[model samples]
Target: MPHCVILYTPNIEPKTDLGALCRKLADTMLTVRDEAGKQVFPTGGVRVLAYPAAHYAVADGKGDYAFVYLNVRMGAGRSAAVQKAAGDRLMEVAKEHFAPIFEQAPIGITLQIDESPGQVYDGKHSSLHPLFNK
Candidate 1:
């Protein structure tokens, strides 16, 4: 499972279409392929969520600075190269998406990928996955 969570300053939300960003990110995740050309991330296991931080400060709290932090968590299986490539692509699209905002204000965009080899406890119950698998 790959769950992408995006956190950004609320100041950027006015000029950002976060819903579109989420869709774009999810779509990009679906396109990641391994060396064998198999999908790196299963279609049903991908999720993108975004949140805007209403109360926050940037830099010395003097300028209008905004930040976008994207944290991607997934089960471990892929190689380091594969993960880096995916992260690169995701960051590329994210930069492209916020280009407008960048020009209008001071902003920082970051993407991080976390691979979980094993969890102490894990659980899942969903019918949505069946739809994608089928």
Candidate 2:
């Protein structure tokens, strides 16, 4: 599963549509492809969400500041290149999502890819993928 979590400051919520951003991220993740053009990430495995941070500090705590921290957690097995590709795409979508807010305020963005070995990460999904396939 690639669970994309966006941790952002509350100050940006007025201009930022978190739900739409999540959907964009999930859609972007699906664009990552293999040599045969198959989606590298499973449709059912995509999950994107955002959380607001009540208290935060950014670069010396001056003025009204905002930040978006992205953490993409996946089950470990994919190659490093695949991970990097996914990360690059994630950041691209994130930056695009927040472009309007960035133009008007002090905002910071960061992204990281985290992995959990299959042994410890367990889950089952029976329906979601089929809907996407069709």
The C-alpha RMSD in Å for every predicted model, in order, reads: 0.9, 2.1
Candidate 1 off by > 4 Å:
none
Candidate 1 lDDT over residue span 1-134, tens digit each: 78999999988878989999999999999999988998988888899999988789888999989999999997888899999999999999899999998889899998999998878877889887899886
Candidate 2: tens digits of C-alpha lDDT, residues 1-134: 67888898898988878999999998888788865676777888798888998788888887888888999987767778888988888898888888998889988899999988746547675688788777
Evaluate residue 13 in candidate 1 and report its C-alpha lDDT on the 0 to 100 scale.
76
Candidate 1: minimum summed lDDT over ten consecutive residues — where?
118-127
RMSD in Å for candidate 2, one decimal? 2.1
Model 1 vs. true fold: TM: 0.96
Residue 83, model 1, lDDT: 92
Report the alpha-carbon TM-score of model 2 versus the true structure.
0.85
Task: For candidate 1, list the clashing residue pairs, or say none.
Answer: none
